[model samples]
Target chain A: MGDPGRDEPLAELADDLRRMVVETLCHAQAGHPGGSLSAAEILAALFFSVMRIDPRHPDWEARDRFILSKGHAAPVYYAALARRGFFPEEMLQTYDELDSLLQGHPDMRCPGVDMTSGSLGQGLSVGLGMALGLRLKAIDARVFVVLGDGELQEGQVWEAAMAAPKFGLDSLVAIIDDNQIQLMGDTATIMPVEPIAEKWLAFNWNVLEVDGHDPAAIVAACAAAQAVRGRPTVILAHTVKGKGVSFMENTHKWHSALVTEDLKEKALTELCVREVR
Target chain B: MVEMVAMRDAYGQALVDLGDRDARVVAVDADLASSSKMDLFAEAFPERFFQIGIAEANMTGIAAGLAVMGFIPFTSTFASFATCRAADQIRVSIAQPNLTVVIGGAYGGVLAGKTGKSHQAIEDMAIMRAMPNMTVLAPGDGVEVRKAVFAVADHDGPVYLRMSRDPSPVVFDDSCEFKIGRAVLVREGRDVTVITTGIMLGRAVEAAELLAARGISVHLLHVHTVKPLDVAAVAAAAEKTGLVVTAEEHNIIGGLGGAVAEALGEHRPTPMKRVGVADVYSESAPNDDLLQKYGLTAGHIAQAARSLMERRAAHAQP
Candidate 1:
């Protein structure tokens, strides 16, 4: 499909995003790298290709909004923002340090973070609010919320899902990163969320399915979400827990584990070699 | 005597006025719009009103999101649900970020005892006050509620407005100045200073008159803002009278009594007594009966004041 990531225009940006995530995690030595690695292509697609944002004016009222619902994946989010010029890329080295703007979770003080989010099952509802606010003010903009598959276990997510469609918030889009793994175990073993697309469809949402690692497919799904009207859209993005690094992929150990220097070097080499191939 | 009105009605009217004055002011409710008195604003600005059904946590997060977009969102629901059910949401979403959202907590205190313990919020103030960057307000009457709403709307950060369900005595007129973090001196005396907040202000006023008739003049202070308490006013009152009594419709453990005790214990350390619901669950009953059962009426406050003053006199003679 689309030359297996070679034809994707934002492929280089996605690769850079993954490298930054791994480096940031290795520097912090304490962060959730699995979800961050899994969400690289999605974050890259949104920040680099989909969102209509100006890095110079992070708080611009008219800019399209993006919220990291699965906020433990802050590494990927920070990488995309830094690459998009929301802040200096060099500042990525200070991630999770004392008094650093880059907190373990997404914070409003950061340059391009639309909403301060870390608690799961919260971003979709917040996005619904921003979408409603935009509609009331007559400001034309869309609100995007990225959710983790494991995060669906929280009941609040369903509450928001039941509300967005009722309000007819066509401008709100939720891209669920279905990594299928959680902190302690697999998502299905922890809490079965299969029939995920059917669940959203039952909630009256315009549902779409895509390969989360494919930036082109994710971009196309986002475009399809915009074409929808009178109902919110949700893209069920199938993904691997750790998409790039071979040892970390499909494993829950990397959900939040220390990244040793050796592992970091190995991970960087693998990511770099894939581009050349 | 002033006309009596429920504090919730004043809150509803304030929302309507705010909606008219500031287009950026929006309202969010959790299916209790009529009970929380947010229906007035909803009826006026139907477009700005967001009904989130019975989901308090989602409602709180939505309000936080709206605040992030530079909109002043007022989220309303029962005090018990708003503070307890969605406690974490308020802490992480609104307080940590310091957003400008006004949270209206209706049916506060044991006066809402008719709804049983599940609905009463005797610890709402304690929960809200413990949160950083939260401005807690328990306006004494309808007029104070109106003024406090307007004041908090103009305020730059998050606020929790605790209101009562039923109508109570009208304590102040439109001229009474209401400012956040400021305490109001209702009357002046050199005897025991009776400090009160929320619906207990009316009872405190009556208690002062009862003490005055018995040859003991009372200094009454209405502390509407529970957090960021007016320590200066409380200290001043205690210094003048040398005896203090704090009354409230909430649990004495962490409500107005607890707040006043903390203030005086750290600053003044004067002889004092707390008149409130003794740390116990309240039962559903008629308003006056429940108040009497919980030792929250005017007679109870006066008795507490008299006993504290007499105890001091006994020790003085010894």
Candidate 2:
């Protein structure tokens, strides 16, 4: 993996992707905006700086894969893919539309999508499978997964955690967007998954802690995860529920909600998407 | 008498043959390697086998991942755990995306005689057949099991292979071909049609012989694949006999009975009767005793055939 130098480019792309997430969800009028906004840095960093993907050849065997384990955050994932030229930017508006490939969650039908994931706690296993598949083919490519903090409550995540270490999958990295909020309410009250780092450590995973919104920090965490040997790494990315949007940040209401035109305008203007365009 | 061979035994031999033939054929088990008959494959290719202990959900997830990695992973376990326990993992990761994974659910239906009702998967066929991309197969005997296993490996998509614990009497010879979704015409008769799947085939064959002795000609159709139901053949059977009877070692509500009823209801418009456990949790009994208690024996099937014929004849008079 290269240094992925120039965190400035990733930061710039993160802002653009955040705008896209807001705009796409607003156009759809329904989606998980909170988690989407929270995962902006992770998606931008992976697509723009980290993952080995070619827009022209999405099915290239040598390409590294990224699975959105917290699949409700499709808006953010789609925005990153579109901006990375996997498909035309115009297709983002057709999200959740009738018969649109832009499903409410990540679908493999779209270009650059590795595995179709939306169900919580399943992606880490899928990514691990792909990583192993790549290895069998003598391809040195790795798998990167982005999961939600609330999703960690699922038991299969730990099952995957247990298997990855035994298999010695250093090329697999799972980053958790620990936004501390879920659909119903805050995670601490709903399901206290605190002592999270130690929980992963107990499962024999190499854990990395980082501020999820920091582009440079996210890049470094990914690199650190790759450098490790004989085990899988899970980066615990602490983040605000709704990182960029002022009204939604750290609140449970925006875990998923209909984006009114007025709220859309405010979010877009704040992100300065018009200036970038 | 024809030889009695367990479907799982056939599956074990099939997996060994597959292991030798295919490089990518890998087996993953949830501590049921020996029971599910995957021990044969494991012994052949130790490195290709992954014994994940007793975690069905993890086994399923890992199999799906291995499938993506370019390995044709055959995950095996008890039918109940494979269908109900790890259902979501199989549905979301494997079914929705149409992953090419073959899941062998051993001791399917009521074949696990003494393991209690929970181990018997009466609702498994219904559960798996409900999934969009799943190909549900419950072969009649060892002959069909060997053929079905290789067929599923070549066929693309999510397939659930249901195998029984006890040795079902051989109903077909090697000359009999097995094809997914195509109902085989076991014995052609003119009076009434007996449709069955899995272990019920042996009982149905016996029932047909019994009916033949009574001067009642019976049309028998063995449906190995439950899902992608062969509605055309069922309709033809319904049209020919004007009456249908379905049998299985499962609940009558959603297994072979339900599939045949649904098909004849829509296409053929024939009167049908279901013969199986009457929607109750089966008890731990000897396999033969359980069959007799559950109204799934050869005698019960013969009785169902006679009763359906009497009903049809009486209705004609009225």
Candidate 3:
């Protein structure tokens, strides 16, 4: 409806994020790769095309807020923030280092981070608070929260899901990274969260299932979320666990494994090939 | 003995006042609205109040959402559920982001009486105090509770306001002003300094008066706000009298006693005695009987103070 072609810049942004994620993980030598790589496209689209935010003024009163509920995917978020000029891109290398602002998880102490998150199932609630706070202040800023599919096992997430619509937090958007693999193993083998979209709808949210890798579809779904007026929106993004990396893709082992030099090079080559195409 | 008022009642009255002053202030309760005395707020501002059912975690998460949206949300429930059931959410979701969420944990310690240990929140102070950027307040009475509520509203960041479910006597009058991180010296003495918080402050006040009649002048410092502790006041009181006695209605391990010891251990080391529930689950009994059984009464505090004085005298003689 709005502009189907608005997704043109998203693909480039996602590619850029993938490269950044790989580079940062290589530099940090200790970070989550699988989930971060899986979430790059979604983060890129949300930051570059979907959300209305100002990089210069990270705490702008009227700016939209994004909460990475699955905080282990900090690499992608840090990449997007650095790219957006929220901080120096060079600082991305110091992620998880002592006294580094780029913490292993998103810390609110860092600029551009609306709420400190990483402990799963909690971010949506905090994002809900921010969205509600904006509405109470009569500020027209929307809140977008990204949650992991595996993290849904946390009972608190369901609690937040039930509450969002009750408050009429229409400005709140929850994006679930429905990556099949979790930390232990396949999510189905560990704890199944199938029928995800139906669950969200049951909780009174406006549910939309989309191809997470398809930047165009994500942008469109996000636009639909913005257009909705009463209930909160949930985008059940169907994504691969280790999206970009050839060896890492669709594997739970890479969820948070250290990226060896060989693995890094291989991952970079795969991302580059994806970029060139 | 001085009259006392329960801090929970003050919280309810303050909620009503806050709702009247600011429309953005809302109360969310998980089926404890009436018990927490939030019915008045709900009755007055039906539109602003939210009955969140029996979901403590959900209530906390929703409150975080409400706070983020620029509304001051006060979530009420039993201390056990408020802290234990939703501790992670409170820590990461609210405190980490530094949202303006006030968690009113009623029925802390043996205040739940017949409900027994399952409902008691002996570990709440420890859990909340461990959190970063959290303001932990344990107001002494109704007047102090009002001050603490207002103080929390003014102070930015997350706050855990521990209140009592039982009806406590009114200690402070309307003239009392609550200041964050400042310990109020209710009863001043010279022999020993007694630092007390929560409902136990009333007991400490009575103990201090009793000690005064027996020529033992005991200084009573009511520490309403636990975290962002009144270090200077506590240190100053400890400095004046080398003997210190800390009293609270919680476990001695991580509650007010432990907090005081930790502070005094770093600042000015003094011979101290802690008056609180020892490490043991409370059994079913009447409120007064439970207080006596758990060593949370005025008599227990006075006895602990006397023993500390004796120990101080013995150390001085040697």
The DockQ leader among the candidates is 1
Residues B1-318 of candidate 3 have per-residue lDDT tens digits of 546566677788898987888777888889998888888899998877777778888788878877766788999899889999999889777887788889989888887858878998888998999999998899888888887877777788899999887768788888987888888988777888999999888788788878878898988888988998999999989988888999988889887889889999999998889888788888878888888888988888899889988886787794
Off by over 4 Å in 1: A1-8
The superposed Cα distance between candidate 1 and the true structure at residue B298, in angstroms, equals 1.0
TM for candidate 2 is: 0.96
Ranking, lDDT, top scorer first: 1, 2, 3
Q: List the candidates ranked by TM-score, beginning with the highest.
A: 1, 2, 3
Tens-digit lDDT track for model 2 on A161-200?
8888888889999999999999999899999898889998
Candidates' C-alpha lDDT: 0.91, 0.88, 0.85
Model 1 over residues B1-318: C-alpha lDDT tens digits? 757899999889988997899988999999999998899999999989999999999999999889988899999899999999999889888998899999899999986737899999888998999999999999999999999988987898899999999999999999999999999999999989999999999999999889899999999999999988999999999998999999998889887888899999999999888998888989899998998999999999999999999899899994
DockQ of model 3, rounded to 2 decimals = 0.60
**Per-residue alpha-carbon lDDT of model 1 for A180-235, expressed as tens digits?**
99999999899999989999999999999999999889999999999988999999
TM-score of chain A of 2: 0.95
TM-score of each: 0.97, 0.96, 0.93
Ranking 1 against 3 by lDDT, winner: 1
Compose the digit string of candidate 2's lDDT tens values, residues B1-318. Answer: 778999999999999998799888888899998898899999989878887777788889878888876789899999999999999999999999898899888999876969888899998898998899999999999999999988888888889998899888998899988888899999999999999999899999999999999999999999999989999988988888888889988889888999898888788788888998899999888887888888989899999889998987888894
- Stretch of 10 with least lDDT, candidate 3 chain B: B1-10
Over 4 Å off in model 3, which ranges?
A1-8, A227-229, B1-4, B312-318
Itemize residue pairs with steric clashes in candidate 2. A129-B65, A133-B69
